[model samples]
Target: MSDGATTRVVIIGGGFAGINAAKVLARDRRIAVTLIDRSNHHLFQPLLYQVAMAGLSPADIAVPIRGLLSRFRKVSVVQDTVTGIDLEAKQVSATGQSWSYDYLVVATGARHAYFGHDEWESNAPGLKTLSQATEIRRRVLQAFESAENEEDPEVRKELLTFAIVGGGPTGVELAGAIAELSRSTLTKDFRRIDPRRTRVVLIEAGPQILAAFSAASAVRATRDLEELGAQVWTESLVTDVSEDSITIGNDGEKLRTRTVLWAAGVHASELGSALSGELDRQGRVPVGADLSVAGHPEVFALGDLARTEDDSGAVLPGVAPVAMQAGRYVGRLIRAELAGKERRPFRYVDKGQMATIGRSKAVVETGRLRLGGFLAWAAWLLIHIYYLSSFRNRALVLVQWAWSYVTFGRGARLIVDREWRNPET
Candidate 1:
């Protein structure tokens, strides 16, 4: 490697995959690591919905990348937007700087895909980063505030109506939380408008929501959403989206609403284009069984940026656990190579999958075991809290959840954006 003494490793992300890779590589004194990301913080994406729902703040689910890896002297965190990658030179080009590396790990994540309708993004925003979550929180809260002052009945109804596209985990969680906020938390907050009458519709293009899960789980989740006053619309396609309305299905049915959230599809990060390879339909780079790029032994890809498969030939889902596992695998593989040991193919362990509905409502599937209701919700809570970046965040989130459960209140509902104005104003 570099100088024949230590291997210079460069990681192009600070997400779950990048952090875990650094953690593993830092233990070896022979490896020098540099982690780069556009954002300074390592975000807990699983809990991003909470921030969007006003159940938690941004700081509660995000921690500075430098702070998390401060103890590791070999790791250096850099905040920069990567522009390109040169395979021949083993260099990563960022906004205004470039770095050379002996081994490279690219874990850049995915972004929302509009399926050829890029203009819709202006009206319906997706939840991925901290700013997007806060913007959603502002929109949801502002809808209610606008409804309170609107003198026209039709306009008020439209303001109180919320439409969430996609019935996946993110969409289901968001719909449930918004329902609870409108019906339970903010019911008595508005004088002129009855927040309890708010209508939430979750639209899915598939025949059923949570299509990735079992049919039984999907049915149960649908029932739970219905019980919370959120309507679940399946087998529907959004044909058009406007500033204050959405058109759906071939029948040309239109829904009038001011707040629409997108959770539909995701394409791999644009950084994947910098590499020379055949990309999948979602723009993910194809990786070998060892998570290395084709024909490039020194380069590796992980997380949503790479299309990976298990031993059984089943493509792995792009989730946090898969990314973490792949990151550790890459680190160990690099270490083994340094030690002149035999390389082993990576193996992914399918732990389980979980999705939370509203309070005390969730579904969990782990191997042959299936759980629902309060017990599943408790398990989900514990697992998420245990996986949080730090003890401080875990404690804060626990306290917030406890307080919200007891009081039926959300404390982080403030809209800090000065440019956002109520339509009725």
Candidate 2:
């Protein structure tokens, strides 16, 4: 404790790292902790696409921050947006309130990055928040609705074309789910335009999709995506995006589309750059071995917001396991501090990595084991359900999966949004 009083540790961003770390820190009675984030709920971000695709609902993947700590008296949860961090004062000012802390943990996670083309954000929005996912669902369903009334084939094709930039997990999942949605869910509903003929493109600047995974697995996933009727374009760079179309490279050529969904690049949250520390090109702070920002003993960073290499010097992938392990470590380090013990440098223990391409197409990579296809898909399902916030969510997601498997259809596919009434138009 500072000045022989209670030490306060304030954590910013109530993401996986912040929430888990807060849970650990609050277990101790020696210090007081405050967890802050813009949202009142901790989101299961990996499953956000499910919500967007109508496989799940908002309440399925999120738990309110205030309700999570009903039994923990030491942990205080605050919902607010942090504008900046005052390193000198060791205080966090957000929502017109200033919170003082003896130590700080910066877990503010990432937002979608537009890669210096801020204008593109307006035309092709990215899905990083629950609101964005809901908006995308609304736009997607609205596209079908608008196409039903339009007579122009050109406009109809534009409405049918769904372009996803970046062949990463989000893009791949979206393409697959939307493919299923078109071929299965909306098949009998649309009479004018064939949702089956809907052109979904997964564009990537890299040579292959799932660049972080094994090349062979990426190849398998590519084949699976092709089977699912998604045009997987590798080495295809996007030049521009608009409401009517997107300009993407096509085998030394160019092509256009109506809708564009950005799954391309996502840097660390802006909170990383606001800190008084050396930031990497991706906006991740180069955390010390112990996960502390350089020259700032009171401040620590983890999750997507931190860039820390392992003992072999290979930087860990920005995956969920990495965040969980880092959160556990930082919590221990803070506990050591409270006990008046010297904290050791953090060492990462990589569990493994897996990505699901579609329902039955997945890839799992561990130390020496590599699994793909249905086996990998099963593994992915179990792992995701295991990590989900509550048993209720796990059960609901499992039921949804089983129902989808048998019926070859999706539930919760509704376009719920405020009706547009444009006065200017």
lDDT of each: 0.91, 0.81
TM-scores for every predicted model? 0.97, 0.94
lDDT of each residue in 54-122, candidate 2, tens digit only: 878878888888887767997888888887789988878887998888889998877777788978886
Compared with the true structure, the alpha-carbon lDDT of candidate 2 equals 0.81
**Model 1 regions more than 4 Å off:** 418-425
Model 1's TM-score against the true structure: 0.97
> Per-residue lDDT of 1-425 in model 1, one digit per residue for the tens?
26679899999999989989999999999999999998899999999999999999999999999998999998889999888999998999898999999999999989988898978987998889888888899889999999999999999999999999999999999999999999899988989999989999999999999988999999999999999999999999999999999999878899999989999999998888876469999999988898989989899989999999888888899899999999999999999899998879999988999999998799999998888888999999999999994636688789889999889889998887645322111
| Highest-scoring model, TM-score | 1
